[model samples]
Target chain A: NAGVTQTPKFRVLKTGQSMTLLCAQDMNHEYMYWYRQDPGMGLRLIHYSVGEGTTAKGEVPDGYNVSRLKKQNFLLGLESAAPSQTSVYFCATRQGGAKNIQYFGAGTRLSVL
Target chain B: QQQVKQSPQSLIVQKGGIPIINCAYENTAFDYFPWYQQFPGKGPALLIAIRPDVSEKKEGRFTISFNKSAKQFSLHIMDSQPGDSATYFCAAENSGGGADGLTFGKGTHLIIQP
Candidate 1:
């Protein structure tokens, strides 16, 4: 089964351009998160959704927006991309229970010039 | 402010050697700590994890040593091999607040030399 899948494996955008990253999970998890990984910066949370139709801000949610309109899909949107937004973005999901393990997707590499 | 701090931005070790990565957190509410391994062009995967109540937990060649008093924890890879080279991350979550998300460290890039 495909655990977590992220679309647009790679992308390049000019400054002020807009784009959307999609994350899909087949594990029927209740929580989904968006994070960006940078050199020496690890992975910082961008936004998250607890369940369908619910979203919340994360550590680095300034330049991004997210929607969880469906149970299996979470979308992260970049209204106006910036150079600083260039990084490898990851999508993760976790089953709601006592176990706190998070499953991640391959990742999406975005470069904003 | 960074809630979790990881040391040694990069490390290199010979084959069959032991490579250790350390992480410390400031939040006492954090009860769950986990380590993730990531290969090039892949997402980070859970390596091993530990709770504050346990002093150590071992799985295969991976081990997690937790020191609750010091708010510190570490990952020790025994018999390291070239295939083990990857970026490792330490993360913490406050389960008390519900599993909202995790606070991740800056990450440790490890290279195992053959």
Candidate 2:
């Protein structure tokens, strides 16, 4: 069974371009998280959800938005991409009945030039 | 200030040697410490994790040593292999409280040379 999968493995956008990254998990997990990884910065939370139809702002929520319309899918969107937003994005999920072990997607590398 | 601080921005070690990466956090509420491994163009995967209650936990060649009083934790990779050449990240989180999202460190790049 597939754990977590992110679409658009690679992307390059203009300064004002917009795009959405999709993440899906088949483990029926309740918690979903979106994170961005920079060169030196390990990983920063962009957004997260405790359950479906609920979302919360994370440490680095600016310039990014997320939605958990379904239990197994989470979408991260950049309304108007900025050069500073260029980085690799990751999505993770934690099982419902665990202390906290996150399963991660491969990743989506985005570049805004 | 960073919620979680990781040291040794980069490290190089020989095969079969031990590579230790350290991390410290400011908040005592953080009871869960987890380490992740990331290869180029891949997402960070959970290598191993430990709770503050336990002093240490080991799985295979990866081990996590945690010191609760010091609010510090470390990851020790015994018998380090070239296949382990990748970036290691330490993250902190509260299992029962806090923001719920993970707080990560700056990360340490570990290179295992043959």
Best by TM-score: 1
TM-score of each model, paired residue for residue? 0.98, 0.95
> Candidate 2: lDDT of A21?
99
lDDT of 2 by residue, B13-111 (tens): 999999999999999988789999988877888899998889999999999999999999999999999999999999998877733557889999999
The backbone clash count of each candidate, in order, is 0, 0
Evaluated against the true structure, the overall lDDT of model 2 is: 0.90
The C-alpha stretches of model 1 lying farther than 4 A from their native spots are none
Which 10 residues in a row give candidate 1 chain B its minimum summed lDDT? B93-102
| Runs with alpha carbons beyond 4 Å of true place in candidate 2 | none
Task: Please give, for residues A30-75, the per-residue lDDT of candidate 2 as tens digits.
Answer: 9999999887877888899988999999889999888989999999
Every model's Cα RMSD, please? Answer: 1.1, 1.5
Q: If you assessed candidate 2 against the hidden native complex, which CAPRI class would it receive? A: medium
lDDT of 2 at B93: 85
Candidate 1, A7-104: lDDT as tens digits? 99999999999999999999999999999999988899898888999999988899899999998999999999999999999999998877699999
Question: What lDDT does each candidate get?
Answer: 0.94, 0.90
Q: What iRMS does model 1 reach?
A: 1.8
Best by lDDT: 1
